[model samples]
Each structure stands twice: as structure tokens, then as C-alpha cells.
Target: MMRQTRLNIRWRLTIWNALAFAFILVAFGIGVYQLLRQAHFDMLDKSLKNRLVTLEESLQEGSSVEDAIRDWVGKFGEHSDYFAFVCDGLQNTVGATATLNQVDINRLLPNLINDYGGTAHDSAFGRIRYASREVQSHGQPLRIYVLAELEHLDEELLLVRRTFLFAIPPALVLSAALSYLLAVRALSPVEKLRLKTDSISATDLHERIAIANPNDEIGHLTATINSLLARLDESFDEIKRFTADASHELRTPIAIIRSEAEMGLHNDADHSRTNKRLSSIVEECGRLTNLTSQLLALSRAESSINKSNMKPISIDRLLTEVVEALEPLA
Candidate 1:
């Protein structure tokens, strides 16, 4: 039973430690994944915004809308991730790259004036993130849209998640094993104390538990147990002495009674001498009875001393009570 209890404690310790570590590891993994995802998307949005600036500059330089579209396509079209589109105030697609001509301009610019910032939307070519802005070019207000493919971003994030999933189980197992070892090392002293105490018996009260570190809690516990053992040893020694002394005190009176009885029986014809022998025997018997009573009273007093919560008595009342108790015998 005790061995099972110890094993339960170690297992509980290991389990609690593993739980704490898992919580921290999971939280850290989630945080990293979010930060990385946001950072990657932010990079894509910035690239789109930068392309918008380049297109605006080309228009400001007095280039026609067709020339600006041609320049943008020639510069960034080769990169399959990039797409550019432009529209007039009527929201009609005016100029666009081959990559973006496939996208529905109406859906891409649903709220051209209101949705001026960046956002992600699904398209014919998987998912795409785009940014839009209104700018004056060639003395006319034009809306611009720049979209980037989201497939690569999604793929990168998927890889990160898979790596984390693969790493978690082995980390948790290692943590649990380390926690179990630490728990065992920490409880070794207590286990030793239990084994030592189990080997101790009443006859072996002189033996004490070994103390490894006096400043620690286990050391203090061992010291207390040893002190209790010392007190028990003293009590046992006192009991042995009491028993021996009581027997010794009774032996002399018993021997005297026997001798006087023998003498009285041997002198049966002489009545006076027989009477004197009988009187001596009676006196010894009285002594023996008195000795027995005194021994009982002493034993009671010692027993009371070992017990707790003794009430105090007034000396005058105590003396009066003693005198009253002995008056009948007197």
C-alpha cells in the first residue's frame, strides 16, 4: 500500500509539471504563428502599396494611362504574384495586366470610395490580397487596384503549423520524464526515513534516524522522531526499575513470614512460644501490606505526572485531606 501511494505521488508530480509546460509551449506556438502570419501579409500589402505609388508617379510625369499600364506590366508582370488594374470614375476597367484582366472589376471595387485601404478577397485565381486608392492623374480622378496571390502565404503558414505539430509531442514527453526524475530525487530523503522507521522496534529505541541536512524540513522531522524515541526509552527504563524495586521490597517480608510460620509449627507443645511466633508473622504481614499500598500510591503518582492537565491544589487543603484520609488507619 505504501509503495503504491509513493508511486501515485510521483505520477501526480510529473503530470502537473507536464501540464504547466504544455500550457506555456502551446501559448508560445500560437503567438509565433500569429505574428508570422501577420508579418507576411503585411509585407505583401506594402509591396502592393509601393506599386501604386510607382503607377501614380508615372501618370504625374505626363505619361498616358495606356503607357503607365504598359510600363507597370513590363516591370512587374513576370512576377506571377503581382497584378495591377485601373478604373475611371464610372468604375469601368480602363487598363489592366493580363494577370488581373481575369478578375471581376465590379466585385474587386465594390465600394471604391469607401474601401480605400487594403483587404483580402477570393477570386478566380485562388485568394488574393489587394489595396486600392483614389488619385488625380492627367487632370482626371482614377481609382487603382493592386492584388497579390495568397497561395504562397498560405503554404508558408501551413508549413509552420506542421513543424510545430511535429515538435510538440517529443517536447512534452521529455518534459514529463525530467519532471519525474526531479520528483524522485526530491523525495529520496523521505523514502529513506520511512525505511529506517519501519526497521525500528521498541527494543531498538536507542537507534536514531540519520540526518543529512539539519537546516531542511526533513532533518527537523527526523530530529523530532528521535526525541520521542528518547522519551519512550526513558519511560521504559523507569518501568523496569519500578518493577525490580517492588519485587525486592516484597521478598524480605515474605521470607520473614515463612520463617515465623515454620517456627510456630515446630513448637506446637509450648503455647507461649507459639503465640510469640504468630505475633511476629502478623507484624511481617502488616509490613508487607503497607509496602504494597505505598508502591501502588507511588505508581499512581508517577502515572499522573506523565499525563497532562493536572489541576493545582492549595497546600492547606491538601494537608487537611491527607490527614483525613489517613485518620482511619491511624
Candidate 2:
């Protein structure tokens, strides 16, 4: 039972520590993942905005939508991850609109919003983010799209996700193990208290605990226990002294009564009836004397007191006086 109690408390401490550590770790991982995602998307959006500005600049020079888009693609294609397309008001392809060779403009047209960059999903290209601008080309209204693939963004997110997935479990395991060790270390004092309490019994109240830190709660508890033991020890000593004194006083009286009763039986003037009564008195006195001795044995620890308050008395006279003061029971 003592072992079980210790284990239960230690296990609970370990569990709570591990849970707290896990919460902090998971929250931190989520925060880092979010920051990385936002940074990547912000970078993509900035590049898309820059590409749109270039396309708008080309169109402002009075070039047709197709020419502006073609020029913009030519300039950025060397180091760019963007594509350009020109479409008419009916969302139809304008001149030489093969700028996005793999991307169908119609697939992108339905998902576009006005003059702002946003994400759109497609079956072939997976996901697309684009910024659009309206331009007047030779008095014909046209729209230019600056788009980039979001597959790599997803890939980056997946990599981060994989990193957390791969790292968190082992981190949690290590955290739990460390938590268990710390719990054990911190609860060592408590374990010692348990062992001390288990070893104590009513006979041995002299044991006490000593801690290096006396200002802590455990120290206070140990002090309280020691105080209780002190009280019990004092009380037990008092009880023992009382028992020994009682037994000694009782034995003296019992021996006096038995000797007097036996002397009565030997008296020549005693009738048969008085002799029978004396025999009964002697038997009862013997029993009482044995009981008093047993009490003295049980109260083995005794202390001597100053007997200057007491005086010597004659035992035979005291016995005679006691007999004269009492009558036989019917």
C-alpha cells in the first residue's frame, strides 16, 4: 500500500509535467508553421504584384495587350516563376495568347476577381495565384493576367508539416522522459517521509526527520509530525509511571492483607468458621497480588521519585488497622 501511494503521486506529477511541456511545444510549432506560411505567401504575392506593374507599364506605352504580355513574359522569363495571358472582355483569347502554353486562360478566367491577387484551384496546374489589370489597347478594352503556380508553395508547406510531424513525437518522448526524471528527483523527500512513517511504531517514537531546507512545506509537515510524536512520548511515559506506582502501592497492600489472613488462620482462638473465612481471604489476596505484579511487568519503564514526603510506618500495625476498618462481604 505504501509503495502504491508513492507511485500514484509520482506518476501524476510526471503526467502533468509532460502535458505542460507538450502544450508549449505544440503551440510553438504551430506559431512557427504559421509564420513560415505567411512569409512564403507574402513573397509570392510581392512577385506577382511586380509582374503586374511591368505588364501595366508596357500597356501604358500603347502596345497591344498581346505585345505587352509577350514583352513582360520575355523580360521576366529568365528568372521569373510567373506567366502572362491577354484576354478580351468576353473572356476570349486575344492575339497570340499562347503566352501560357500549358495553362488554359478559360480555366483561369472564371476564378479571377477584379484587379486583385488571389488563389484559384485548377486540375492541371493544381493551384494558381494571379494579379490582374485592365488596360485599353488601341481603343479596345483588354485584361492582362500575371499568374504563378502555387504547387511550390504547397510543397514548402508540406515540407514544414513533415518537419513538425517528424520532430514533435521524438521531442515529446524526450520531454516525457525528462519530466519523469525530474519528478522522481523532486519527490525524493516525500519518498523518504513515507519510508520513515512506515518504519515507525507505537513502541519507537524517538525517530525524527531532518531536512536541509526547513522553510519549505515539507519541513513544516515533518516538524508537526515530530511535535505529535513528542506529545505521545510524554503521554506514554506518564502512563507508565502511573502504572508502576499503582502496582507498587497495590502489591504492598495485598501482601499485608494475605499475611494477616494467614496469621488469623494460625491463631488458636479462631473457630472453624473464622478459619474458613481466613482461607478465602488468603486465596483472594494471592490472586490480587499476582495481578498487581503483572501490571508492574507491563509498565516496565519506571522512574524513582523523591520520597522525603513519605515516612516509615509499621506494616503489621497498618494491616491490623486495615482489617479492623473493613467487614467481610455477605
Candidate 3:
């Protein structure tokens, strides 16, 4: 016995559709996140540059740069804002709004003068946002360094990342659901085909797959299958008719042989009568041989019809040739 294999088109389609949806959604999400991060960094860079310019202008004023810086620093601290520092070439802090402890000044002063000049430096200090600018005063060049706590912007960035991360699960779930529904909708025709096919059996070979539509690939497939089934049904009918006809044709010859043998056996040593019966048996055998040969030829013809390669041919020429070949047999 051969084992039957079960197929489920719905589950197959669902898996394929879900995978496609996930691939597209993940690619889109990565692109959007990268764009957002780039925009954030650009905005932060621009803001740092503007603050550095403001500090430089304030320092160039005729008033005491240290005093002016102290006032600015006091106001900034009152508002819980970022601190600024201005230094001369000697590396000594000339003007600083915030108190410069040894560690704060030491860690920032060298990097401000050497590592950065009129450029934004994000990695100068560990976890500190620092920007610097070079300014000329009284024919002397000075470096102004600005330091701001990155905690606020860092927090905002962290929040954005978390929000996107959290959204991914729901997005994926929604995409999967939509993909499954679409797959189901797309495969409904196939499901119908399955049901129709299941309803038919070998005993009902006369039944065929319905071609509900004729313009699509699925319709074409249904039509082809139906055509095959129709051919099978015709071949089976021809086989049944041939079997019946062959049995009828053979019965007469078999009966004649049996009757002739019985008569010859019952007759009393009549040579003439025995020879006549024997001749009749020989004739019946010849007839049986012819019938069997004809049956075999028909079977071969039917098999050839089923397996032959089809091509365009002139119908009139083909028919004329067939008739000429069959003239003797007819």
C-alpha cells in the first residue's frame, strides 16, 4: 500500500507572506531610525556652535571678561543651564562662568587648546558635551571653550530609542496579521480547487475540475486538468467497449472448436468426417488469431494516441494516406 501525503496550502502561504512582511518592515524600521539619529546629531552640533559664538562675543566686550563671564555663569546656573569657559594662550582660565575645580579645568583645558579649535568635540571628556572656538582680541588669538551637560540630550535620545524599540513588536504583530489575511484571501481559489478535487474519485473519473475563470493562470491550470480528466474518461470508456466487443468476437470461434472436437470424438472411426471437423477447428483457430491480432493493434493505437507528440498536420493529406494504407484491410 502507498502512503498518502497531506498538503495544507493555507499554512504554506501564511508562512511565506509573514516572512516577506517582516523583511520589508525591518528594513524600513532600520532606515527610519538611522535618519532620525542623524537629524538629532546635526541639530545638537548646530546648537553647540551657536552657544560658542555667543560666549566669544561676550568675551570681546570692553568690560571685565571674567566679571561678565561670572554674571553669565550665575544666570545660567540659576536656570540650571550649561557652563562656559574662556582661556588665554597661557592655559590659565581667563574667564569662566562656573567654578573650575582642578580636575574639571585640567581635563578640559588641554583638549580645548590642542584637540579642538573652532570645532565641536564630542569625545574630549568622558560623557561631557564640549565645543570650542578661536577668537582674536587686540591682535591676540584666544580659545573659548564651552561645556554643557549631555544628560538632557542623552536622555531624549534614549527615550527615542526606547519608543522605537517598543513600537517594533506591535508593528511586527500587525504586519503578520495583515500578511496572513492577505495570504488567505489570495489562496481562496486554490482552496476551492482542493475541495473540488477532493469531491472527485477514481470511480467518478467522468467528473472534472471546474474552470470558474478563464483569464488567469489558475483558470488555465483548472482547464488543463479538466482536459486531461476528459481524455482519461474517454479512454476508459473505449477500453470497456473494446473488452466487450473482443469477448463477443472470441466466443463464436471458441464455441465452434469445442463443438467440432466433441463431434469428432463421438463419431466412429470415420476419417472423412474427422478431417472435416479438424479443418473446421483450424479455421476457428485462424479466426481467433485474427481477432486477437486486431485487438492488439487497437490497444497499441490507443496507447500511441495517448502518448504521441502532437504537431500541426494537414488533415486532408493525413486522411488520404490513412485510407490508402487501409484499403487492403477494408
Candidate 4:
């Protein structure tokens, strides 16, 4: 028994649309997240470099660098921007707007000054970000470190990330809807073909599937199915004609045999003559039977050949068997 496979075009379209939407969502999300992160970090570096330049100018002027830094810190501290510290080349703290803990001054300060000459170094101190800068002032090299807490930046980034996350569902929904609409538009001709196929029946097998677009695969499929239907319709018509012709041709011999048999039986004829007529009638009946059986067998064999599952047989043996079987008839 053959199991029927049911197809639902809408379900197929929905699944494919969802997959495409998911791919676009993931790609866009990753791109947006990376771009935002890069922009945020760049802004932080630029702000730090600008602050370092201002601090350098104060020191070069021989003004009280501490007071200048304190004033600047006072102005910017309310904004929660950064903390600054100035140190000599010997790693001794010369001036600082904000006091540093002993460990930070000892361990991290020297490393920042050594590695980056007139450059910034970003580091983390207990969840806070510090952008440290080394500078030269009045022919003397100095180190200036700026500490800016990243909690607020992280919070904002988190908000942006959450916004993106929230946007994804809507984005995916919109994209899926768009994809489905597009797929439907693209497959409109296929849908029409399906409806036409459903309308087709054995009685209307001569009807061909309509083709709206000839360049597409669906159009090609429509053309091929229509061609197949045409062939099937032609074959059925030929079979009907052949069956009618064969019946007509066989009827005369069959009627003649029946009439001869009846006449022989009715007449009180000689036994030998009666036997001869009976034998002739029997031979005619046998010939008719053989012809009908051959037609049926040929029809069955043709069906099997079309299906292409016939077992391989030796042609020579088959021909010999056919000749032997027909010898009695001959």
C-alpha cells in the first residue's frame, strides 16, 4: 500500500519566512551591539585625552596645578565624569584632584606611566574604569591619571542592549510577515496551479494547467504536468478506439462459430460431419479466447513496463517458451 503525503503550502511558507527573519535579526543585532560598544569606548578615550591636555597646560604655566585640577574636578565632578592625579617621573604624587588609595598609587600608577608616554591606559579598579595618561610639563615629564566610573556607562549600555532585545521580537514579527507576504506574491501562480489541479478530474483530463509565468520553476512544473495530462488523455482515447476496433473484428468470427455449432446440433447430420463442424467451432472459439487473452496480457505487460519494476528475464528462453506454448494452436 502507498501512503499518501499531504502538503500544506502555507505552513511551509511560514516556516521558511521565520527562518529568514531569524537570520536577519541575529545579524542586525550583532552589528548594532558591536558598533555601539566601539563608539562608547572611543568616546571615553577621546574625553580622557582631552582632560590630559588641559592638565598639561595648567602644569606648563607654573600655576598651582593642584588648584587648577581641583577647580576642573569641581566643575566636572558633578557630572560624574572623571578623577585626575598628577605625578612626577619618579612615580611620586605631585598634585591630585582626588585622593588615591595607597595600593592604587603604589601598584597601578607606576605601570600606567611606564607603558604609555603621553598616552592613555584604561584599567579597572573594583568595577570602576580609570583612563591613565602620561604627559610632559615645563621640560619635566609627569603622569596624569583619570578615573571615570563605568557604572553609568555600563547601565546605559545595558539599557541599549535591553532595548535591542525588546526590539527583536517586533523586528522578527515584522520581518516574518513581510517574508510571508513576499512568498505568497511569488507563489501566486503556484497557488492558482494547485486550485486548477484540484478542479481537474478523470472526465476533464483533457484540460491543461494554466501557466502565468514561463520563466519560473513553478511555471515549468505547470507546463510539465499539463504535458503529462495531454499524453495520458491521448493514450486513453487510443485505448478506447483500439478496444472498440478489436471487439468489432472479433465479433464476426465468434458469431459464425456460434451459428455453425447451432445449425450442426439442429440438423440430424452424419456423426463424422457433425464432429468436424464441432471441431471447427471449437477451434474458432479457442482462437477468439487466445486473442482476448493475448490482448489482456499485452495490456498488463504494458502497464508493468511503464512502472519499470519488471524482473530481468533471458530473452532467448522467453522466445523459446512462447514458441512452444503456441505450437498446439498452430
User: Which runs of model 3 end up more than 4 angstroms from their true locations?
Assistant: 1-8, 61-64, 67-81, 99-102, 110-126, 202-206, 305-330
Q: Is candidate 1 or candidate 3 better by TM-score?
A: 3
What is the clash count for each candidate, in the order shown? 0, 0, 0, 0
Per-model TM-score versus the true fold: 0.73, 0.74, 0.76, 0.74
Model 1 weakest lDDT span, ten residues long: 321-330
The segments of candidate 2 whose C-alpha lies over 4 angstroms from its true place after superposition are 1-7, 78-80, 95-103, 113-115, 136-140, 197-204, 267-330
Tell me model 3's lDDT, rounded to 2 decimals: 0.70
Residue range 1-330, candidate 4, lDDT tens digits: 999986567657877878877887788888988899789877877777677677666766766767768766665564445667777878787776555555556665644543433333335443444565666676788767766666777888899889988988888788778877877887787778888888887788889876877898987999899998998888788788779978886876677677667768786558887886777777767878968876776677656753334468899997975564343334
User: What lDDT, from 0 to 1, does candidate 1 have?
Assistant: 0.80
Q: Rate the local accuracy (lDDT) of all candidates.
A: 0.80, 0.74, 0.70, 0.71
Lowest summed-lDDT stretch of 10 residues in model 3? 117-126
* 1 or 4, greater by TM-score: 4
Candidate 3's residue-wise lDDT over 32-70, tens digit each? 777876786677667666767766676576446676576
- TM for candidate 1 is 0.73
Cα distance off (Å), candidate 3, residue 73:
4.8
Error of 3 at 320 (Å): 28
Q: Residue 329 lDDT in model 1?
A: 33
Q: Give per-residue lDDT, candidate 3, residue 229.
A: 80
- The 10-residue segment of model 2 with minimum total lDDT is 301-310
